[model samples]
Target: MESYDFIVVGGGSAGCVVASRLTEDPDVSVCLLEAGGTDSSPLIHTPVGAVAMMPTKINNWGFETVPQPGLNGRNGYQPRGKTLGGSSSINAMMYARGHRYDYDLWESLGNKGWSYNECLPYFKKAENNEVHHNQFHGQGGPLNVADLRSPSDLLERYLQACESIGVPRNHDVNGAEQVGAMPTQVTQLNGERCSAAKAYLTPSLTRPNLTVITRATTHKVLFEDKKAVGVEYGLKGQRFQIKCTKEVILSAGAFGSPQLLMLSGIGAKENLDVHGIPQIHDLPGVGENLQDHIDLVHSYRSSSKRDTFGVSMQMVVEMSKAVPQWITRRSGKMSSNFAEGIGFLCSESDVQVPDLEFVFVVAVVDDHARKIHASHGFSSHVTLLRPKSIGTVKLNSADPYDAPRIDPAFFSHPEDMEIMIKGWKKQRQMLESNAFDDVRGETFYPVDETDDKAIEQDIRNRADTQYHPVGTCKMGTPDDKFAVVDSDLKVYGMSGLRVVDASIMPTLVGGNTNAPTIMIAEKVVDSIKQQYALLKQTKTASCEPS
Candidate 1:
């Protein structure tokens, strides 16, 4: 059994950052296991390649939820990345840190050193923003954040539409406040996708101290007397065990992290009994508190396909030319991230902050874009930034290969439906603005556009995830029964084990989760280094003096 100072499971967004930063200190050797293949596909690099990968299992987990009764008995599709970069390699690459109050809420929940003020440094430390150099933005960092290289004219139109509906333009969504519309800043470098793997892992690949194993699926974390010591995993049908001399960090994302803990017999006794897995530690919150941004999309057919992407014969010819244009110059349609324009607004006038987030896409997206249409169109995604309903991730079976049962419980809360209805109503005002008069053709759903009941029924029939799922293994104070990990991200009642991913969020952030997930990894890496530094100092002093 080979050993390392640290073993990080899941080479997704957070895992990449942890492995890269830990290996920066040559003394600390680290091993990173990725369940998927390497992020070497052209589909993982080109910005527009995201659309092609969404419908296929290529580098995507493509998990489906248990039928949600809230969505009129529909099974929502959940696509996660199965590559070294993880979802970052397959996502829209929108770089958003949520709102300042989002982190402040973490501190208010007794998670010390996690307030926006404390977390800001880590966000800056991980970012290399190409534009907006201010106190909030950073330069000379690993993760590159920049404006879109090929922004669509529809983006301007979307902003104009928002303005027509009394929404102001926000120059910088990540700075000062997140209250208005703007062209989304993306995680890209030179018009290419700057996934966490590209930003963090690619540069650290040559480091001998960092051992990155792709196509390796971790079955369970091995523990000795409730202390994590190693992990049992499979690679090419061969089961193997690797020792962790110091710590076992689970960065397998929200879903994978909690599922791994349960597999390791560290969940509720009742849950383990059903699966016949012996309980090591009973933590009831292993897979509880699942939260996601439930989104309602409005798709509209367009009269012209000049700037919008479509699936017609004309676009086939356009894309044939576009493919080479992007390969050679790294510019044009291929560089567009699709969901280019963003807006933040309040569902109710009395709300303190914006609760509704609007994502404007340059093409029609049906069922997370899995359903393709031959017509030219655009879509506006209205996501409830924070939902009151909670969900769970339970074991489908004892087999590690089986996908976990995901129940987001979207709209289970009456208030969630209420807010969503209001948000959908507000979103329609923007969709019908005069700015889109020249391009807009036909509204796809909600035949009775003015009726509130029709709009509510339409939302219940079509509402789904915006792909931001979090808070399964939540971070909280020790006394909190639902807490999976403490403020420092250390698993409660367990030593040598930590969770450094979106799962650690006590509550979901208000925007895209990718950037905040990277920041969590950065912050946790700092904690890991500081802990050992203090230990080293104590050991040195004990040897030198009394």
Candidate 2:
């Protein structure tokens, strides 16, 4: 068995960072296990190639949610990156740090060292924003956050339309306030995608102490009573065990992390009994507090169609030309993240912070761009940022290879639906403004927006995930019965094990979860190092007098 000081599972956003940062000491040996292959695909490297990955399994785990009762019993499409960067590899590449209050809320929820001031350092530590080098964003870090290498005039018109609707243009959405529209900062370095792998893992691969094994499916954590000592995984049709001398970190994301927990018999006692699996520790909150932002897209046909993303015969010609340009200089229409512009706002003015998010895509993205259209158009997504509805990820079987059953019970709260209706009305008002008159062609959805009932129906029919799934293994105080991890991200009642990912978020942040997820890894790894400082001293003493 290969022995390591730290064993990090799932080489997605958090796993990659955990492994990369831990190996920086050179004395620490870290092993990262990813079920998918390396993030070496060309599509995974290009910004616009996310469209191709969203619909297919190429460097992605295109998992579909169980039928959502709140969404008219429709199954939601969830495309998570299975390769090295994980979802960061295949995501839309928007670099949003979420609202500052989001972290304050974490602190308010009985979690110390999670206030905006405390968490800001971690956010800045992992960020390398090309612009906005102030107290809010960092200039040099592993994760590259840059402005759009190539933005379309159509996006400018969209911003203009937002401005006309009394919405101010935010120079930086990740700045002091996150309530206005602007060009999205992307995870790109010189026009190419800067996934977690490209930022942290790739640069650290030369370290002889760090070992990354891809295409390795982890079954469960091997525990000595309550202490997680190692992980049993499979590779090349063979089962292998690797022991971790220090700790086992589960960075398997929101869904996969909890599923792995349940598979390891560390979930609700009843769930473990139903599956005929032996229980290790009965932690009722292991896979319970699931949440995600539900998005309702309002797509419109673009009269000009020249700049927007669509599959017109003329667009096909343009794309063919753009591909060569992108190949040569890494700058063209092919460099777009598709979701170029975004904004955050409160659905109701009474709320302290923005509760809704608007994502403006250059393409008429119907169904995450799964619905192909031959015409030129644009789409705006109105996301219910803090949905009241909770969801879950449960193990379907004892088999680790089986996909977990995911049900993000969206729109379950009547208030959430009401907010969606408000967002729809606001979104429509923005689109119908005179600023978009030159380019806005026609409304593709809402057969009739005659009344609030009609608008509500439209939202229910169109509402789906914005792909930010989180809070499966919640971080809470010990009194919180549903809390899975503590403020230090240590799993409850477990020794030498922790869940460090979006799953630990008690509440979903007000923006994209990618940057926050990376921040969690950066923050937690520091805590791990502090907690395991004695191990270093023990090793040094063994090499000295002994």
Q: Pick the candidate with the highest lDDT.
A: 1
Q: How accurate is candidate 1 locally (lDDT)?
A: 0.92
Quote each prediction's TM-score.
Answer: 0.99, 0.97
Q: Which residue pairs show collisions in model 2?
A: none
State how far residue 207 of model 2 sits from its true place (Å): 1.2
- After superposition, which runs of candidate 2 have C-alpha atoms over 4 Å from their true positions? 538-546
lDDT of 2 by residue, 388-467 (tens): 99988998899999999998988887889888888888888888888788788888885555598878777777778999
